[model samples]
Target: MTKPTLIFLILFSLNFASISALSQKPKALVLPIRQDVGTNLLVADIYGRTPLKPVGFVVDLTTRHLWVNCETNYKSSTLTQPKCKSAQCQKAGTKYCHTCPIAARPFCHANTCGYYLENPVTHQNTVGELAEDVIAFSSTNGFNPGPLVQIRDFLFTCSPSALVELKLPKGVQGVAGLAHAPIAVQNVLASKLGLKPIFTMCIPSGNSNGVIFFGSDGPYSLLPGLDFSKTLKYTPLTISPFDEYYINVKGIKINQKPVPGLNISLLSVKDTGSGGGTTINTLLPYTILEGSIFKAITSFFAQQLSKVPTVKPIAPFGLCYESKYFSSTLLGPGVPSIDLELEGKDAVWSIFGLNSMVEAHPGVLCLAFVNGGNEYRAKVNIGVYQIKDVPLKFDLSKSVLGFGGPLSGARTHCENFNFTTVA
Candidate 1:
């Protein structure tokens, strides 16, 4: 071959090799999550800024956008505001222009994409500028983490410092929205990376850290050779107009016995848009049931555990028992299991002692569920405490929620994700 031909062949080989290496790299993103001891909320550490500083964001299940306070001492060289008419602003479903009385700064800019952001804790609303910045995350191949990858133009919002309420835990600068909205971090990752619209979360119950995996369907490998994905049971996942996730719970049972006096109709979403239905939330620490359902379940639960010595009820907890009377098992205090029957056959999510019982005081153990006041929208609101230790796979494209039964049943837990190993 001539010199030019040889040179062309060499260049082609180098180009092919570069493309092959890029393809082999993981397409998934992983974030290490830890439960906030003070608020009982979940928080994920995200890498931001040039030197890669870890920013704490409280994970919000229903928040529409990931927003951070940029009022004071907030600095990011990569931060850029999307123009009012830009595609990013349109994708965010907002065309309003943000204005500020204060001089121009990070959040105070002219003709910027404006968005209405809310504080999940205090329910306070504020209009903020929709901005983009370079954000980094650890790449994973389902089994182990790969190199740290950067998203050059990540979409998010910058709000005033006042929106950061006291209800949020200390050191947490913002709220990471994981809802179905376009601007949500998960949806943004899916659209920008061309990966599957799926994310898995393992919320740890104790002090140990948990994890969130975005953009990959996985064999959610935990310790001791266990893969959470293999054991998952899926149910139809619905979304409300506000982008909140809802699961169809057909019925409830205690120890294989149907919970009596339950108005099963209330479990279905109403067409009138008034009330009724069941939804899940990470913000709520304990599950809350409607008035009638609460009464029925609490009465039955108390009757089932009649043999266990009863103690005076603690505030917010209707029933309490002497902690010493119950024996501890792998799941928790030995008690009858509660089950939420889903849409499909044998589609039951069971709650063992670990999630069913809560220690109210030094020697008092109470039911982990709460009584949603006399009038409430959703009949049953499943909370973090009830779903703790379970692996959740949310498939946005398919509109399905996969639940991996309590990890303790398999002698593993959410904290088992091997974060120490980097691919």
Candidate 2:
């Protein structure tokens, strides 16, 4: 080869190698969440807090900031309290500077930003110093995890252990806030990495790990290379002033028939923000509906399944029946499907038997729903149990919710996601 030809070949080889490396870099951050059956809480694996310790955090959808227990021998070289006037403090919406009456420690620092962190499980509030630390997550190509990506100064509150003493699941140290707040881990990661503010969650119903992806839609590639994104149905997502997610659900249906006596006006939000509406909540285990809505739904459901022998009602469950009477389908129990009539043409979120009914006891199946009482603000509160096994994408940038309705329609489930580490 001539000198010029050899030089051209060398440059081409270098460029090709660089492109190959870039292509292999993960396009999204992935977090594996395990379902704690006893507590009905979804716990996510997080590696952080100086020296990088692996900790489990309950996934809280309504929490504004990530709060962790730092009162017990918490030591991190990268932990630093933000000044009251710092940008970090402003982002957290706290203005008061904290004062420590006792000795200053990690969360009890003086002249630092004071933030009120809530225990998602107990709903108890405590004041803690707003601080930053190094948090890391595994990067993924939307299929398998690649390597660890670090966020050098992730913002969180160093809370006391009292908030979690008896409330949270065992081995879980903190709450990972995935709400629509600016300081939420998902948004911070997206902003820092220059990616779109979007996230997708597929909660597993079984013992296996579920998957959550930040910044990409899919090639979700559960076993058999199925992409749940293809089945997604789009609907406008409304974020309340309180940072809760609400959908434009106009009505409800059972077995393709609309429930009678459902006050259409009761399904809407009022001007005072205290009237009836539907909102999604991960903290809640079962779907809760207003008293009237609940009565109408259960009455109609029981009527539809008249062939099944009724049994004495369970304490929490209003209706119960012999489980043997019901047949099994790939979707779930062979029961009537419930549909949420949303805004737009043909936008209905169908909830199959798996998402609608729960086996409260052996040989006994009950509707996995609760009456929110007449005073409940939201007419419909969609909980995590009803959302599991469905691929849900929250596009904060576009204010849209893309729901890949029940995967059973495609003969797959959320637990099918491969968790094996990629080399």
For each candidate in the order shown, give its overall lDDT on alpha carbons: 0.81, 0.79
Alpha-carbon shift of residue 180 in model 2 (angstroms): 1.0
**Per-model TM-score versus the true fold:** 0.92, 0.91
Model 2 per-residue lDDT tens digits across residues 1-423: 223223323333333333224434357877777678779988876778667676778998788878888888678898998987999998888998988877665468778998888887777887877889988766667766555667778988888888878668887888999898988878888877766788899988877777888887666777767887777888888777778778878888999899988877777655316657788888888998889888999999998998888898876778899889888988889999999998766679999999988888888999999988875567889899899888889989988888877777777777776555352
Each prediction's Cα RMSD? 8.6, 8.4
Write the residue-wise lDDT of candidate 1 on 4-120 in tens digits: 223323333333323224554357877777778888988876767654466779998889878988776677888889888999999999968876567655467888888998898
- Give the count of colliding residue pairs in each prediction: 0, 0
Give lDDT: candidate 1, residue 63.
95
